[model samples]
Target chain A: MGSRLPTGWRDVQVAARAVRLVLTRPAYATAAVVAAWASLTVFVLSGNIAMVRNLVVSGPLSPGDRLVLVREQYPFLGTNYGTLEGVAVLAVAALAGANLALVAYHLREHELSASEGGGSLVGVVLGVVGAGCAACGSALLVGVASLLGVSGLLLRFPFGGLELSALAVLALVVSTYWIAHGLRGGEVGGCPVDVGGRR
Target chain B: MKQTSRSDRERTAGVDDGRPARRGGREPEGGSRSRRRLLLALGGVSTIAVAGCLGNGGGEADGDEDAGSEGGNEDGGGEGADGETLESHPVGVDLAEKPRLGPDPFDAPATLVVLDDPSCPRCAAYHQGTVAELRESHVAAGELSIVYRPYPVVYDWGERAAHALEATVERDPEAFWPLLGYYFDEQSSFTSDTVLERTASWLTAETDLDAAGIVADAREETFADRIETTLEAGSAAGAGGVTPVSYTFVDGVFQSPINGSASTTAIETALQL
Candidate 1:
C-alpha cells in the first residue's frame, strides 16, 4: 500500500490501457477511424466550407477534382510555415478521435450522467474552432473572432494561431485521461490512487 | 492494521455497485460538487482563453474594421461622387491588360474584378461555383463583365501560374481564360517544381499557343513586375490578405467588396440583377 508513482504516471498508464482495450474491439476501432476522418475533414475545410458548398452546388468541379483540391490545400503544406501546421492538424484529429472513443467506452461501461461526457464535448468544440491555416486564417476562427468583436486580431498571433490548436490538443488529451481514469475504476472526483492491491 | 481493497471499502460503505464511484450515488455531496465546480471553472477559463487568444486582447479597441474599410476606399481610389458613374476605379492595374470574360467593360452593366490565387482551395471553389454560375447567368447574357487579377497568396507555385497566365495573355489573349481554367482544374497536380512543365505541356496539347515560349517566359519570370503590380493593386483594394476576393461595380459605381468566396447570390444582389 506504499507504492508511490510519479505524478500523472498512473493517468498515462490508465489511458494507454484503456485505449488498447477500446482499439482492440472492431466496433470501437471503426468508430475511432470514422471520427478521425470526420475531424480531419472539418479541420481541413473549416474556413472553406462555404466555398466548398458553393462548388458542389453550382461549381463545375467533379467530385474527384474537389478531392484533389482539398488534398493540396491542407494548411501550411505548400506555404512557408513548413510542415508543423500539418502535423498539428493530424495530432488534433487523432486526439479528437481517441477522446470520442474513450468517452463512448466510459458511457457504455458506466451509468454516468451526460455531464460526465462534458470534457469530450469541450475538446471537440475547441478543436473545430482552432482548426485553420495559421498563415491565412480559418473562416471558423475569423467568424468566432468577429462575433467576439475582434475581427482582425488573429493576424497578430506570433505563432499564427498555432497556439489555439495546441490548446485544443491539450484539452483533448486531458479529456482522454479523464475518461481513461474513469474506465480504470478510479473516482473522477478523487485522486487516481491505486487501491486495488493489484499493482 | 487490516488491508481492504478499494472495491471492498466501497461495498462496506454501502455504495451502489451499479453506479460509478465518482457519481457519489450514496456518498457525500461535497467531493462531487467540488469536482463539478472545478471542471466548470476549467471550462470557463479555457473558453475565455480561446476567445482572448483569437481576439488578441484588443477586441474593438483597435478600430480594425473602421480602419480596414477606410483603407480599402483609399486604396481603390474608386470612391464615386454622388450620382456619378465611372468606367472603373483607378485601382492602378491596367484593366485592358487583364483577361476578360463576357461583354466589354464599357458595355456591361456590372463589372466584377476578381483577385485569386490558382493554388488556393477557396479560389478553386469560387472558380468552379460562383464564377461558373456568373459566366452562364450574367456574362453570357451580356449583362456583366469579369476582370481577372491573378494575385498569388498561397504558395510559390501560384506565382508561377500567374507568370504563365501573363505569358498567355501576352501571346493569345483568348487562350488566357482556358489556361486559367486548366490551372484551377488541375491545381493539385502542379507543384512549384512541376507547374512550368505541366502548364507548357498542357498548353501544347490543349491549345495552339506557343507552349515553349510561355513556359520559358514563366521560368524567366517575365511577368514578375506585372504580377507584383496586380498584387499591389489588390492589396490597395483591400483584397490583399485573402484569395478569391472580388470587387463589384455596377454602372461604374463601386458596389461592394466580396471577401473570401463570393456566392452567386451575393454577387447577383450587388449587381442588382
Candidate 2:
C-alpha cells in the first residue's frame, strides 16, 4: 500500500491485485475461463446460429473435422487474426472474461447487486455487437440500422465499425478499474472498515 | 454499553458493511469524483467515435453525389426528354437460361436476381429469411421468379462452393437447390481445403446424382469459366465485394438494386407487389 502513489497508478494496482486475488481461487479461475469461452462463442456465432444447428442435427462429423471447421470459421468477424479487426475480437473476449470474473468475485464476496454490474453487462453487449463483422459491418447493427433505412451509413465507419469494438474494450477496462477501486477502498459490500486509516 | 447497529459500525469504521455504499448513504468524495471523471471521459470518447462515423459517412455521401453530378455532366447531351440518361436507368439482364426458382422468367411478372457467396453469413440470412418468404408467397403464386448467380466474394471456400454448385446444377439440376441450401445451412463446417471433399461426401449420401463425377468436375475446374462469367456480371452491376446483392425486375425492366440482406418487405416494395 504506497499511500503516496498517484491515484491512477494506485487504481491500476488495486484493480490488478483484485483480479489476481480472484483468479488465484480455482473456482473463480474456472468461471473466468468458461465465461471467456462462452463469450467468444457467442461473438462468433451470434448471427450464424443456423450453422451450429445444422452441424448438430446433420450427419455426424469426426472430432478432428469439427475442430478444423471451427478453426476455419472462428474468424467470422473478419478475414483472420492477422488484421487489426480480428485482434480486436480477441481483445474483447479477453477483457470480457476478466470483467465478468471480477463481477462474479464482487457478487460472491461483497454481495454486489445486479445493477452494480451494469457496466460489465453493457461491455458484454457492446463486445458482441462490435465484434460482428470487420469488413461488411456488424450484422446486428446493420439489421437495426436497416430498419431506419441507414444501413449504408455503417459503410462510413473508418474501420468498418471496429471502433465499436474498441469502445467495448475501453468500457471493460473502466469497469475493471472501477471494481478494483471499490475492492481496494473497501467501498463495496460490507468489508471491515479501518477508521484509524490502518490497513 | 450503547447498542450499535451494523450501519453505525460501518459509519465509525469507514468500511463497507455488506451493504451497497453507493446507494443509501453519501459516497466517499474521492470515489464519487473519480466515477464522475470516468463517466465524463467515456461520454467524450463515445461522442468522438460517433462523430467520426458520421463524418466519414457524410463525406462518402458527398463524394458519391459529386461523382453522380460529374457523370450527369458527361452524359448531358444524351439525356432523354425525362432528363434521364439510358445509362442512368437500370438495365434488365437475360435470365432465360439462368438457374432459377418459381415460374419461367418469361412467364413471371417479375424476376429477382440474387448474387450470393456461399461463405457469406448475410447471404445465408437473406436466403433463410427474405427468400423463404418470397418463395412461399410470390414464387408459389407464379407472380415472381428468382435467378441465383453464385458470386464468390468472401473466401476461397466460396469459390469452391460455387464450383460445387455449378457441378451440381450441370449434373442433376433438381439437386442444385438442396446442395445450395446445404452449403448455406452448414457454411461454417466447410473450408477451402475441405469444402469440395465434404460436399462430395454429403452429395453422395444425400442425393441420387453422380456425386463422384460432380466432385471430379469441381476438382478439374470444369465450370471455372462459367463462374468467372458470373463474377464479371456481378462486378459489372457494381456489386463490389458485398454478397446477397439483389436486383429486382418488374415487367422486364430493372427496378432496383438491393444491397446486403434485403427484407421480404423491401423486395415486395421493389417489385410493387
Candidate 3:
C-alpha cells in the first residue's frame, strides 16, 4: 500500500522509498562505495594521462570560445583572477557536492512524512560516498595540474600557492558538511522525531 | 481478515485520519488515489529522461549548423576590431604575412599540423592567431615545415561536402598559409558553395596559384582518402576530434598541445622562444 499521508504530501513517500532503496540495499550500497573509489581512480588516471604532454594547446579559439571566456573569464579571475582559474574548477566540484547533499536532504525530510524512521545508516554511507566524489574530483584537478608541471602558473597569484591536494581536502570538508548535514538534517539538528532518535 | 489485527487496523486508521486532516475534508478513498498519481508522476519522469537523450542527438546535428554560422560571424567581426585584444601590446607587424622570417620570432624548429574545418570559426581564429605566426616566421624562414590536414569534419558553409579542406591542400601547400590567413580573416563573408569557390578562385589569383586546377582536383575527391586517413589517425591518437587540433612534433616526437592561447607562453618556454 502507498504510504499513509495527507493530500499534497505524496512526494514525501516517493522520495522516502527512493532514499530507502538506495540506502538499504547491500548491493546498491556497495556500488555507492565502489563509485567513491571509481571517481578517485578516474581522477588519478585523468591527471596522469593529462601529464604526458608538455604543451597546452588552446584549441581553435572559436569566436564563441573567446566570447564565452571573455565574459565568464573576467568574473572568474576578477580580484584573484590569476589564481581563481585553477580553483574555479574546484568551486564547480563543490557546487556539485552541495547539490547532491541537497537531494539527499530532501529525500530524508520527505521520508519523515511517512514515519519518524527515515533513511538508515546506509543513507549516511551514501551521503558520505557522494561527498567523497566531490572532494576527490577537485583533488584530482590539482594533482593533474601538478603532474603536468604547470603548478608554477599559480605562483603569480597572492594566495595561489594553495596546493591542489589542499583543494581536494577543502572539497572533502565542504562535501562532508553538505552530505552530513543534509542526511543528518533536523533529527541531528535536535528536531524531535516520534521515535527514530537523531538521524 | 486474520481476526482484524489491532496493528493492521491502526495502520489503516492512520490513512483514514490523514484524509480528513487535508483541509477538514473527508474523502475515504483519497489516500489510495494520491498514491497512484505519485507513482504515475515518477513513471513519467523516467520516460522523459530516456526520450530526452534520443531527442538530443538530432538536436546536436542542428546545433552544429547554427554553431558554425554563429562562429564565422563572430570571428569575422572581431578581426582588426581592436576592442577584443587582451593586450594592445600585440597587433604589430609580426602579426601580418611575410615571405621570410629572421632569427627573433621562433628560435627552435616547430611545425604544427592542424586538422581543421574551414567553416568552423574556432579553427579560423586559431589559424589567424597561432598558425599564421608559425607560417610568417617558421615556414617563411624554412626553419619548420608546416603541414595542412584540413579536416572538413563539420558542415563547411552548409554545402560542397568536403570541398573546403581538400581545396586548401590540393591548391598549393606552399601558399596554403597565406590563403588560410585570408580565409580565416574573412570567414563570415563566405558560407556557401559559390562563395567558397569564389574565395578559392580569389586565393589562387591573390597567391598566383593554379586556382582552376586545384578546385577541379578537389571536386574529384582527390584529397578524400587523405582526409579520412588523417581524421582516423587523429582519433586513434586521442584527439577530441573538434576543430583546431594541433599535432606538433616539438623535437620530432608528435604530441598534442595544452588547451588555450596562454599555452603560447608555455610553448615559448618549452621551445625557449
Candidate 4:
C-alpha cells in the first residue's frame, strides 16, 4: 500500500475521505457537532460554577472573605495573547453556530429517522434540563430532601449540586451519542412501512 | 442498509393513488405517514428546545443600552461618607490613562468594572487568563476601561486584602494597582501570618508606597465606609453573592453583570453587543 501511493498523497487522501464521509452522512455529522457543542458548553459552565462553590463552601476558608487586597500587586500589564485567545473563543462560538445550522439543514432535508429524531428531541430536552438544574444548584438534592423530610441527609454530601450537575451532563452526552448513532444507519427514516400490504 | 431514498418511499407509500401499496418488510402506508409526521414533529420540538438554549445565551446581548444604568439606584442609599457613587470608588490612582497604553479611562465610552477577590483562585485564573489577555487587547487599545473592585467575599484574608486595597487607594493611589499586582502575584503568602508579614515588607521595599502604612490603614476604620459602599455597589450591580462578579458599562451606561470568572471571549461578545 505504501509503494502504491505518492509520498504526500496519504494526507490528502485522508482529508478527502473525511470530506466524503461528512458529505455522505451529513445528518450524523450534524448531530455529533450539535451534541458536542451543547454538551461542552454545559460541562464547562457547570464545572466552573462547581469549582467556585467548592472553594467557598469547603476547607477552612471563610464563605464571604477574599484572599488578596491590593491593586498594585495585580501585575496589571498588557500581554500579546489577546488575539489568539479571542480567535479560539470565536472559533468555538462559530462551531456552535454551525452546529445549529446543521440541525436546521437536516430538518429541512426531511432526512431524519424516527429514532434519530426522537433521540435528538430527548437529548436537547435533557441538555436544557441539565443546564437549568446545574444553574439552580442542589435542586435535585433539595427535592429529595423535601420529599424524604430528612434535610440532614444532605449534610454528609458536600458538592451535591456539582455531582448532580455532572451526572446530568453525562446523561446529555449519552443522549447526544444515541442520537448520532441512531442517525448513522440512514437518514431516510427509521422503520419502513409496508404500504404494499394494504393493496 | 436500506437502499430506498426518502422521496422514493414517500412515492411508493402514497403518490395520490388511493390504493396503499404493501411494501414488503415495511409497515402499512398509513403507519409510514404517521411515523414520518411524528419524526417531523419531534424534529420541530428539538429545534425549538435547542434554539431556546441558544436564544437564552444570546438574548441578553440585545438588551437596551440603558437597561442596567439604573441598576445602581436599587441600593443607591448606601453611599460612602464622601457621598459619591460607589461605582466611582476608584480614587488616588489616576485612571485617566495607562501612561503609554490606551486613551483616558474617563473618556472611554465603555467601562468593564470587575469585582474580584485577590484571594479567590477563580478570580486569579480569570485575571491571569482572560483579564490579562483583555488588558492586552481592548484595555490597551482604548476600546474599554477596567475598574477593579477588590471584593472580599470568600476568605478572612480577603477582607484584610480589601482593607489594604482601600488604604492603598486612599493613601497612595499610584501604589494601589502595584500593591494589587503584588498581592495576586504572591497570593500564597497571604495564607500564613509570617508569610503575609514578609509580603508586606517586600511590598514596602518593592514599591514607593510604605508597606507598614498600608497595613496600618487596613486596621483603621478610615476606608471602612468606602469598602462597605463598594460592596453594596457590586451587589446593586448584580453581584449575586458571588465574588469576581463583573459589570460592563458602555457609553457610561451599565450593560450587564458577568457572574463569576467568565471567559474573555464571553466578555468580548458582551462588549460587542
Model 3 ranges off by over 4 Å: A1-199, B1-108, B133-145, B156-171, B188-192, B255-262, B269-273
Best first by lDDT, ranked: 1, 2, 4, 3
Give the CAPRI rating of model 1: incorrect
Go through the candidates in order and give each one's DockQ: 0.07, 0.04, 0.04, 0.07
Residue lDDT tens for model 4, B1-273: 235455445533421133222233434234455457656767687666544333222222222221233122111111112222224533212333221124444556656667777665546666777778888888777788777767665455767877777777775566766666677787755762543465478667877777787777776745777767656554433332344655555555443454444566556654552
Give the runs in model 2 whose Cα sits over 4 Å from its true position.
A1-199, B1-94
Top-lDDT structure, candidate number = 1
Error of 3 at A173 (Å): 23
**Chain B TM-score in candidate 2, rounded to 2 decimals?**
0.68
Please give, as one word, the docking class of candidate 3: incorrect
Candidate 1, B45-119: lDDT as tens digits: 556634433322122311223224312221122221223233434342587788889877655788888878887
Per-candidate TM vs. native? Answer: 0.53, 0.47, 0.40, 0.46
Considering only N, C-alpha and C atoms within 3 Å, which residue pairs clash in candidate 3?
Answer: A55-B258, A56-B258, A57-B257, A57-B258, A57-B259, A58-B260, A62-B122, A77-A81
Scanning candidate 3 chain B in windows of ten residues, the lowest lDDT window is B70-79
Q: Assess chain B of each prediction and give its TM-score.
A: 0.71, 0.68, 0.51, 0.61
Alpha carbon deviation, residue A51, candidate 2 (Å): 28
Question: What docking tier does model 2 reach?
Answer: incorrect
> Which window of ten consecutive residues has the lowest lDDT sum in model 4 chain A?
A66-75
- Identify the superior model by DockQ, candidate 2 or candidate 3: 2
lDDT string, candidate 4, A82-160, tens digits? 2322233223333333333333433443243443334334444444433332332222233233335653554224442
Residue-by-residue lDDT tens digits, candidate 2, B220-254: 88998878777655544444454666766666555
